[model samples]
Target: STTAMAGSGLFRLPAALNPMDWLAQPDKPGISPEPSYQRPQGGIEARAFGNVVHLLVESMANAIARGEEPDVTQWHPRAHALLRAEGIAPGDLPHQTQQVVRALENMLMDPEGRWLLAPHTAAASESALEDETGRHVRTDRTFFASDAPLASGEGTLWIVDFKSSENSGSDVAAFLAAQKKLYAPKMLEYAQTKRAQLGAETPIILALYFPLLPALVYWQAE
Candidate 1:
């Protein structure tokens, strides 16, 4: 199996492949590698905005795990302080903080969101996975059923990747279609790696959580 080969280091795979890389069609005989395009780095304001939202969500999840309602007001100050400490401009903090607060509020109100964020015995944030050959992948959040069986189709694992695009637009259907095209292979890779580490039969669900949009998109491994 590809997963087994990856874990055993018997197969030489690319060290890392982003979603776009996985989406590329290089199998055609006439195909040539696309010219490298260096995307511009997100401005400090944008970077800080995402960082602040992520921090708020992390804190909220932690609070939920501890049986407490997350205080957005408290987190707002903390996020602002963090941005200041990191040299992020203060001008963007207010709007970004409000965005984070609204996202959290929506998540708390949505039943599916609440379920996904529910406290679990086995949960990890910013989890890292690496094979013996140093090939690696990272996930934003993961939850495993505590008593799930390792055998095929008897247990479930949930892996989430967060996206922070403010420009995803109002067309949910179109956005989802594009997202599936871009992220399907990457999510499958993450699931395959987890199966290799866990067991072949354990079912995995990969999710893309857009906190700013307050949306949850998911795919299940076959």
Candidate 2:
């Protein structure tokens, strides 16, 4: 199988993406930033905002994997620093800090969010894996969960990518459907690369986690 070739490091997905361009903006047509939580200073660039969120989540994931509890209360100062580093003006730091911190807290407090981020064997954040074509595939998060299997006997390998978009449309179903359509290809690629590394028989699950909307959208990969 191609996956087996990839596992041997002989086959990999082509290297087409730059590390800096890994994030995708959710502000596509018909989708907009959540109005209620919009930044007071207009708003930061979508990519910049996403970078900050991804960094924080990465930090939290590593901490969890290391058996350290994340202290949400202490996140404000960290958020301020991250936003400032992202070129956010100092004056808008307070509002943006709160926004980012609150989102993190919500993820920890929410059941689905916590489960997606929960510690598992070999859990890693911003994991960079090589495919058969010498392409580097960077995944937002990947973990092994023996307890959560997609089938009766198979252990589950999870690939979760984070999105910073918030859903504002009245039709929640349609909004999520659009998001899945927009991102499934990339997620599928991540799954394929992983399936090769882990073997074809292992069940791999692909997920897009939206911290802003506090939602988990996942499906099993064939």
Candidate 3:
């Protein structure tokens, strides 16, 4: 007696296909058996740290897109609040604030990071899109880069997803390569979706940006 609508909320996309989950790995062993106990009053856990960085970068990118300078001083309170919301202890506010501020500084100072956050035509942060299957996808950032060799009238469309993964291993090159491999599937989906929407004539550059490492790994989305 009921007809199913394609875009109905009930038929939402699988979370596993989300870019956020592409690089997700099993939790590493922590200092404490209880997860909450592992994050001390003066410390931040990996997920919380990643959240802080992502939020900060999103805010900064949005600002740049609007032709406004991102103010670092204004972000401290916001970062503190986000950390608290993510379960950081009240006593850890100062330490957490410094950690986030340092990350913001590092991103702003790095040429590659800055370029990723730079303004471009039709720039947007956390841009949500939908696919033909009625699945919703949220891209970390999207914009049109006019500097690219013209493949179409609008130049190149860029889809950038940010990752906060840090490497503790000795082989930095291997670490980056591994990350790209892990996320390639989801990134390809993003590129395919855009290509379907924008047509094959447009050039699309799909990239993974690791701000913490101050590195960028990118490839053409063909």
lDDT of 2: 0.64
Which pairs of residues clash in candidate 2, taking residues 3 or more apart in a chain or in different chains? Answer: 11-132, 12-131, 12-132, 12-133
Highest TM-score model number: 2
Instruction: List, residue by residue over 109-178, the lDDT tens digit for candidate 3.
Output: 8766787788655666666566677676667777765323222223456788777676788877788778
Candidate 3's C-alpha runs over 4 A off are 1-44, 90-96, 146-154
lDDT values, one for every candidate? 0.58, 0.64, 0.65
| Native-referenced Cα lDDT, model 3 | 0.65
lDDT-wise, the better of 1 and 3 is 3
Q: Over 4 Å off in model 2, which ranges?
A: 1-44, 146-154
Q: Ranking by lDDT, best first?
A: 3, 2, 1
Error of 1 at 106 (Å): 2.0
| Per-residue alpha-carbon lDDT of candidate 1 for residues 13-101, written as tens digits (9 for 90 to 100) | 22342223322223333322322111223776666666666666667787889999877567667766866765665686677667766
